[model samples]
Target: MRVTADLDLCQGHQMCQVEAPAVFGTDPDTDQVVVLDEHPDPALRPQVDAAVKYCPAMALAVTD
Candidate 1:
């Protein structure tokens, strides 16, 4: 699966980090949510899905 985060739409809520710490995080300089691993391991699909679902800004997208 693949993950994408729209910086423009993000509010830095950090929900992605909570769900998938290994695949997402906040950029210190931009203070925005960043996709640490766009193409994360298959094992991380569940957490990534949760992150996308919980994104209040609707900034995250996932695709297989």
Candidate 2:
């Protein structure tokens, strides 16, 4: 699946980073979510989905 992060909506909560570090990260300079991998391995879908679901700002999304 493919992951997407809306920086404008991101609050830098770092939940995504915690759930899926390989797919998401934090931008120290901007304190926003960074899409480390727009497209991640399918095996990582559960973690990615958790990140998206837990994002307080609802800035994360996933698509197949």
Scored by CA lDDT, what does every candidate get? 0.92, 0.92
Which whole-number lDDT from 0 to 100 does residue 49 have in model 2? 94
Regions more than 4 Å wrong, model 2: none
Predicted model with the maximum TM-score: 2
Query: Which window of 10 residues has the lowest lDDT sum in candidate 1?
Result: 27-36
Model 1 residue pairs with clashes: none
lDDT tens digits, residue span 1-64, model 2 = 8799898899889999999999998889999998989889899999999999999999989998
**Candidate 1: lDDT of 18?**
98
* Candidate 1 lDDT by residue in tens digits, 1-64: 8799888899988999999999999998887898889899999999999999999999999998
- Report how far residue 55 has shifted in candidate 1, in Å: 0.6
Per-prediction TM-score to the true structure, in the order listed? 0.94, 0.96
